[model samples]
Structure formats: C-alpha cells, structure tokens
Target chain A: MAKGSLRINEISNAANVLLNVIFILLSFLCIYPILLVIGTSFAEETYLNVVGYKAFPKVISLDAYKYVLSNAKPITNAYIVTIITTLTGTVLSTLMIALYAYAIVQQGFKYRRFFTFFIFFTMLFNGGIVPWYIVCTQVLKIQNTLIALVWPYLINAWYVMVMKTFYNTTVPSAIIEAAKIDGASELKTFFRIVFPIAIPGLATIALFMTLRYWNDWYLPFMLTSDPKLSNIQMYLKRILNNLQELLNSSSAAMQAGSMLAVVPREGARMAICALAVGPIVLAYPFFQRFFVKGLTIGSVKG
Target chain B: MVKTVVKQLKDKAIEIKKKKSFFKDLHDNREYLLMIVPGVLQLILFNYLPLFGLILAFKTVDYSKGFFNMDWNGFKNFEFLFKNPDVFTVLRNTLGYNLIFIVTGAIVPVAVAVGLSLLKNKTGARAYQSFMFLPYFLSWIIVSYLVFGIFDYRLGIFNNIISGVFGREAVNWYQSPRYWPTILVLLHIWKTFGYNSIIYFAAIMGIDSELYEAASIDGAGVWKQVLVITIPSIKPVIVMLAILAVGKILNADFGMFYNVPMGSGALMPVTNVLDTFVYNALKINGDIAMATAAGFFQSVVGFVLVLVTNHIVNRIDSAQALF
Candidate 1:
C-alpha cells in the first residue's frame, strides 16, 4: 500500500511539473512580444536601417525616444488632456455613484426598488451608438471638446450598482443610526462616517474609471477632430492612422511623404507605444487587488 | 402601536413625530434625495436622451437641420444598408468571427485557469499570472504596435525568423486577407484569454477543496479529480460567460478588427465587422443615416438575444442568470 501510494505521488508530481512547464512557456510568449517592442524602441534608427528590427538589438540608443519627445507640444498637450479628464471624471463619477448607492441602501428609503431598477435596467439595454453620438453632438453639443472624453463614461450604471451592493452589505446599520442620534445630517454622515470606510470601494471603482478613460480611443475618434483635444491613446492612434495611410498608398510620393511625416519612423512609433503603455503597467501592481475584486464582484453577481 | 406611542412618549409632539406620515418621511430625507440628483440627471441625459435620438435611424440626417429636425425617410436607411452588395459579406464576417470567438472564448480561458489552478508552485503561479495579465492592461493602440513589431514586412521579427533562420519567403502579413482571420483570432486570444482566465481562476478557487480531498481518498487521480470535481464546479461560470457572449454576438471588437491589421484595405473583406462597418459607412459613403440604421439593427438583435439567453439561463439556474 505504501509503495502504491508513492507511485501515485510520483505520477501526480510529474503531471504537475509538465503543467508548470507549459504555463512558463505561455507566460514567456505573452511577455516576450512587449519586450521586443521596448527593445526596438531603444534601438538606434541607424541600426534599424542597418539590420532592421530584431527582438534584441546589437546597438541601443535613445534617439527613438528623443525623436518622439522632440516635439513637446502635441505629446505634452495630450498628457495634460488625459490627466485632467481622468482625474475629473474619476472623482465626480465616484462621488455621484457613491451618494446614489448610499441613498438606495438607507433602510427607510421608500424608493429603493424603484431607484435600483432605474439604474439596473440601463445595463440590459441601450440606444445604439448613433443615437448616443447624436445626443452628445446635437443636444449636449460636446463634440470636439475635452468634455467629450469625460462625459460618456462619467456614470457607468454597473459601477453604481457595484457601489450600491458594496454599501448595502458592508456598511453596518448601527453606525448610521449612531450618526443620526448624534445629530449628523445625512450628507454629513455620508461624508464623515460612511465615505471614510468606503474608500476601498471608491478606490476600486476609481481604478476602473481611470483605466476606461486612459485606454479609450473610440470617443475621440468619433467626437473630436482637434488633435490637442484627444487623449494620449487617441493621439497615438492618429499617428498610427497616418502610418497606415503611408503603408497602404500606392503612390511613391505619399509613401515618401509619410516616411518624413514623423509617424512612420518605426523606432519613434514604438517609443510612442512604450510611453503610452508604461505608466499603466507601473500602476498595475498597486491596483491589482482592486481589479480582481471589482471585476469578480461585478460580473459574477450580475 | 398607537397606544405605545401615546402612553410612552415624554413629549406629546414626539408622538406625532414617531407616527410618521408619508410627506413627513419625504420631507425629513430631502437632503439625501438631493444628494442623488446628479446621478439621476446623468442617467437621464446620457442614457434616456440617446433613446429619444434613436429616431435618427428613420431620418435622413441633414447637418443644417440636425438630428430631430431631419426629414423622415421611413425605412430607407435600413434598406440602403441591407441592399448594398457588400452587406452579405459584412454580415457573414461579423457573425462568423463572433461564432469563432464564442467557442475560443469559452475554452481557452477556462483551460488556462484550470492549468494555473493545478500548479503547486505558488510563487511561480503568481509570477506567471502577472506576465499573463499584463497584456490585458495594454490599450489596443499599443497592441497594434506590438502586432506591427511581429508582422511588419521589412522590420518584423516574424519575417526575420522566417527568412533568416528557415530561409522562408517573407509574407506581407497585413496585405493578405486569407491569413487575417487566423491572425485576428490569435490576437484576440492572446490579448483577452489571460484576463478572462482570472475570472475562471477565482471560480476554481471558490470550489470546495474538500470535494477534491474526498475524491483523492476514493482512489481518483489528478486528471480524474479535475474531470470529476473541478470542471463541474466551474461549469456554471463557463456557462454564464458563454451566454453573456451570445448576447453580444452581433457586436465585433472594433479595435481588434480595425487597428491590429493596420486597416490594410485588403484585410477589410475579412475584418469589416458590424462596428467597423458603421465606421466605414461614415468614411466611404458619408452616409450617417445608413450607419444609424446599422447601429439600430445591431442593438435590436443584441437586446433580443440577451432576453432570450437570460430567459433560458433563468430556467436552468435561477441564481446564475443575469437579471
């Protein structure tokens, strides 16, 4: 019996080793491509001209990054635009969501079911993209403005639902009753007592909001024509759009014109990619818990 | 209740307060009501306002008169979108790619998640997870660059590996439509499966460990336990994800189709999905009305699909159904 158990252990151990090997290979494939992008970005343009692109370069230089950063106007403008919108959007949206969520969770609040359904119903259906565009452009008149980036994602119904659930389950009823006994106003109780404890919840939603605003290129593509008004993602996309034109055009003149257009310079393009991707990766570790928890809670329940 | 309030109250005014009227309750919580106004207003403006604008689908949009003021065309916009020769191709492409995505989406993430769960090495699993999940955070524009690095004709590592090592001819990857369906699917899997796997991983973690321990004592092996205990435990999640995916089958990922192949004209035949089709309608025909009709069509189909699937899921498992 002892010998049989040892044999069983050996076979399982071998299986486990094989599984780990497969996972390692997969992780390497997933990560190596990004490294290739970074490597090519650091490779000198002359070396790029000499050997073309490789996973690892013989000569590494900062010229690609230097060229990308050389014109500070567009890059700086995009950064300022993205940062401002991300901050403003995340803050206002989280507050709006939290307060509304808090209102529904109040025990004596008579309209709880009505308000909950009001938000939850939006999650199931929506007027299509064209109507959304028309509403933003014709009615709101937010097209070609900074507000275009911030407004559409400002109140995701799902985020409000998540906050509502979080508050209902987590916030103790005794604490709110105590606050009321102390003569705390409803808003004062929320701000002083509930909001403080709900920071983790707020932070989780904020991370999602930040990611949404940061990663979005579609809104700017549709709504804005002004380059300065676009976020960094959209700005990079504009450059990419130009590169595609160059690559696809049959005319030699257009192709040559594009090579000089600062967009088709491969090293510079890769550098643009690196710049856009770098900060989010750096922040990923710190917010990893929030993402896992938020996504799990939001989807699994819904 | 009335007798207790009347007899126990120290102040007679407190008796009236304790016996609250509807208006009194409303009046007392007015500030809390005020706090939720912005959220309510936001939903009304962005969401409900768009529902009203869906009438644009029935109109010929005139920039001069704007959306609501445009001339009514009845169903002419839908007729235009559906009547075009390219309509069948675009429809096939959209539904075909979604079908493929649904299958792979169901399988790949669950397999990876299960694989990750089975690993006994904790530190190795964590490290591997970070690497796997990194791509999830990358914007598609950046992903486009990564794809560019792999497949660029002159400078791509793929060409280098093929031509230099194997002496194979370098194929202009973006120019060929035949290769694109495969390439696009692979790209989607790489970019998403890891992130999707996290959901599966969590589901696996939530499975009762005692089930596996019990299986082991019954002479079940590793694969047997996985088959008998693990897969069944996470089946609900897998089903849930698949059903949710079915609801959005009409909507193709715009970025994956548009940005990845670098919008090469040749790949349009393969990559022109519903979302991209709308964008192209704007670009090629400058026909906003037709685009609106297409958007309306996608929305109606998606909504119906969701309701049908939700009904089906509700019948099977009440708890797991998306309400």
Candidate 2:
C-alpha cells in the first residue's frame, strides 16, 4: 500500500512538471510574435524579407528606426494627443465618480435611491450608437475638438457603483460622524478626510480610467475625421490600413513607399503599444494589492 | 384673541427651527456631496446626455438641414433595416458566434483554471497565472498581426514548417471562411482564457481548505476532491457569468472579426455579425437613420433579454440576480 501511494505521488509530480513546462512554452508563444515585431523593426528590411522574422537577426540594422524617427512629427503629435487625453480624462472621470459615489452612499441624502437607480438603469440599457453619434456631432458640437476625446467616457456607471461600494464599506462611520461634529462642511470633509482614506480605491479606478482612455480607438474612429485630433491608436490603425491599401495599389511610387513604411510599421506600432501600456505597467506593482482588495470589496457581493 | 395670536407665533417659531435644522443637515454633509459632484457631472454630460440623441433614430439626417430641422421619418429607418437581407444574416452570425463563444469559451477557461489550481507548487502556479494573463493585455490589432505572422501564406511559420517537412502546399488562411470559426474560437480562447480563469481561480481559492482536507481524510483522491469540492464551490460564478453573457448574445467582438479577417470578402459569410454588417452598410449607404434604427433594435432586444435572464435567475436563486 505504501509503494502504491508513493507511485501515485510520483505520477502527480510528473503531471505537475508537465503542466509547468506547457505553461512556460505557452508564455513564450504569447510573447514571441511581439518580440518578433520588435526584432524585425531593428533588422534590415532586405534581410527580413530574405530570412523572414527570426529569433535572432541575420544582419543587425537601425535603418528602420532611423527612417521612422526621421518622419517623427506625426508620431510625436499622436503621443501628445494620447497623453493629454489620457491624463485629462482619467482625472476628470475619477473625480466625478468619487463625488457621485459619496453622494449616493450617504444615508441622510433623500434622493440617494433615486440617484442610484438613475445611474444603475443606464448600465442595463442605452440608446444605440447612431443617436449618440448625432448627439455629439450636432448638439454637443464637439466634432473636431479635443473635448470630444475626453468627454464621452467621463462618467462610467460601473465605476460609480464600485466607488459607492468602496465608500459604504471602507470609510468608518465614526470618522464621518466625527467630521460632522467638528462642523467640517461636507465638501471639505470629503476632500480632506474621505479622499485620503479612499486613495486605494480611487487609485485602482484611476488606473482603469487611464487604461480606457489610452486604449480607446473607437470614439476617435467614429467621431472625428480630422487627422489633427486623432489619438495614437486611431492614428496607428489608419497608418496600418493605408499600408494595406498601398501594398495592393501596385504603383511604382507605392513600391518605394512600402520600403519606407516597413520600418515605421514595425517600430511605430510597437512604440505606440509600449507607450500606451508603459504607465499602467509601471503603476501596477504599487497598486496591485489595492486593486485586488478593491475588486473583492466592491464586487464580491455585487 | 391676544392669547390666540401669541400661541400662533410660538408655533411659527417652532416651524422655523425645524427648517433651520434641515438646512444645517445639508451643511454638515457638504463635504461628502462635493466629493461626488465631479463624477456625477461627468456621467451626466458623457453618458446621460448622449442618450437623448436616441431621438435622432426617428429622423432623416440632412447635413444642411441640421439635427433638429431634419425630416421626420417615423418608423421608416427601422423598416429599412429590417427589410435589408444583410440584417438577418448579421443577426444570425452574431447570435451563432456568441453562442459558440459562450459555451466553448466558458468551458475551456474553467477547465484550465481547475487544472492550474490542482498544481501544488506556489512558484509554478503564480508564474503560470502571469503567463496566461499576458495575452489579455494585448490589443486585438496586435493579436491580428500575430495571427498573420503564423498564418500568412508566403512567410507564415505554419507553411514554412509544413512545406519543408511534408512538401504540402501553403494555405491562404484569410480567404478561407470554413477555417475561421475554428480559428476565431481558438484565438478567442487563447486571448481570454487567462482573464476568465482568474475569476474562476479566485472563486476556487475562496473555497474552504477544510472541505478538501475532509475529503482527503475520507480517502478521496485529487480528482475526486476537485469533482466534489472545487467544481461545486465555483458553480455560482460560472452560472452568473453564463447569464450575463446570455444577455448580450446578439453582440459579437467587432474588433476581432473586423481586424483578423482584414476585410477578406470571401470570409464574410461566416465572420460578418450585426455590428460589422451595419458598419459596412453605413460605409456604403451613409444612412445614419438606418444605422441608428438597427442599433436601437439591438439595444431593445438586448435589454429585454437581460431583464428576462435576470428575472429567471431571481426566480431560481435570488442571490444570483444581478440587480
């Protein structure tokens, strides 16, 4: 019986080893193609065409990077637009959500349920895209403006709900009462006391808001036609789509264009993706514990 | 008469004091209210205000005529959408793809998560989890590029290996509709399984270890313990996720379908869903009203489905209902 048990343990250990190997291989698979693009960008275009994308370059070259960086004006513009929109949108949205959440969670507020339902109902249903597009273009009149980028996604219902739950759970009732007794006005108390305490919750949601803004391509795709107002994702998408068209165009000039495009196509895309995710990844470790805590606190019951 | 006037004045004073107390209550809660104002205003402007634009579905848009001055078309736009053959095809594709996604996509992640959880080493498990999650961070555009690198007829690794080994002809993956459903599903699972597994893994983690200990004490093996304890503990999450997915079964991942196929017309039959179809139609016709009508139709149907699903969930188990 003891020998049989030992055999079973060995089988399990082997299975575990196999699983780990598979997982590690899968991880490499996930990261490989991305690394390929990065590798190909630095390789001579001629070499890449001859050898195909590889683990190591046949001939190392920075010609692509040079070509892409040479026409760096548009790429830099895209970066500026993306950064500004992300920062503005995240801050505005987080502040608004924090306030709305606090108000709805207040027991003394007479309209709390009404306001909560008003926000909650939006999550269940919405008017479709066409009407929304027309409203923004016609009524809001933000078609070509920078505000268009920041405004549409400013108030997220789910975030508000998450924030409200955070407030209801984390903020001690006694602390709030003490603030009230000290004759601290509601706005002052919130900014001074509640805001500090809820930083963990706020930071996680801020990261979410930042990611949403940075990753957003749909709004710019649909709402704005002006190249000047385009975000990085949308701009890159355009460049990519244009490349496909150029590849199919069969013009002599386009053939020349293709060589020039190949470098930027690889480097620019990787650069944009890296830039978009860089801040979030940097901030992630600091907020990792808080994010898990906030998600469980806000979501488990909901 | 003098005595009566004095009593009336006293009553008035008491009423004034109550009003003062009410205002004072508002004053006391001012800080909390201020904290919530920015979030509320942003939502109102961005989310709520755009909802009013739903009215434009009833009108024929003329750029010169302006939004309010546009010709009223009653139900004509919606009629046009329903009348189009493309709408039916799109609706069928959307529902079919999503159903496949929900069923298969749901199962694979749970299985993967359970398998991972069964692994006993702390270091290996954490590393595996992160590995699985890496794909979730990537954009669909990036994912499409990766797919291209693998499946490209000229330079794809698949063709390079197969032709070199077996002397087979290279396949053009994008033009093949027959292969897309499998490809799309596999890709979807690859991209999303890690994220979905996190939820399931979290749920599994929450299960009391004591239950597993008892099962082991009873001489139940690992598989038996997983079957008896782990699966049962995570059943509620699985059910909840299923119901939520059912609510939006009419929608497909537009980015995945549009980008991965890269507008290869040959693959449209299997790949085109409502959103993509509507996008194509809008591109061709520039008919805002028709697009809005279709969108409105989707929203309504989707809303009704969510309500029905939630109602059913409530009936079966009140705790599981989203509301």
- Best candidate (score: DockQ): 1
lDDT of 1 by residue, A1-302 (tens): 01112222223678789988998888988888788888888887777865667668888877666656655567778888889988998888888888988998887677767877888777767786777877888788999988898888878887887887788667888999999999999899999999998888888898888888888888888899987797899988877878553233245434443455333377877877778788887788887767878766655553
- lDDT by residue (B77-190, candidate 2, tens digit) is 888888987777788889988998889767977887777676656567766776676666666766666676677676565776777657988777877789888888888888
Backbone clashes for every candidate come to 0, 11
Candidate 1 lDDT by residue in tens digits, B216-309: 7889877787788778888888887777788889888987888887878888899888888887776567788888888888887888998999
True-vs-predicted CA distance for residue B159, candidate 2, Å: 3.1
Least accurate 10 contiguous residues by lDDT in model 2 chain A: A1-10
lDDT of 2 by residue, A25-66 (tens): 776775676666556556666666655554456787665555
| Model 1 stretches with alpha carbons more than 4 Å out | A1-11, A243-264, A299-302, B1-29, B63-69
What is the CAPRI rating of model 1's predicted complex? acceptable
A136 Cα displacement, candidate 1 (Å): 0.8
Q: In angstroms, give how far residue B153 of model 2 lies from its true place.
A: 3.3
Give the Å error, residue A299, model 2: 3.7
lDDT of 1: 0.80
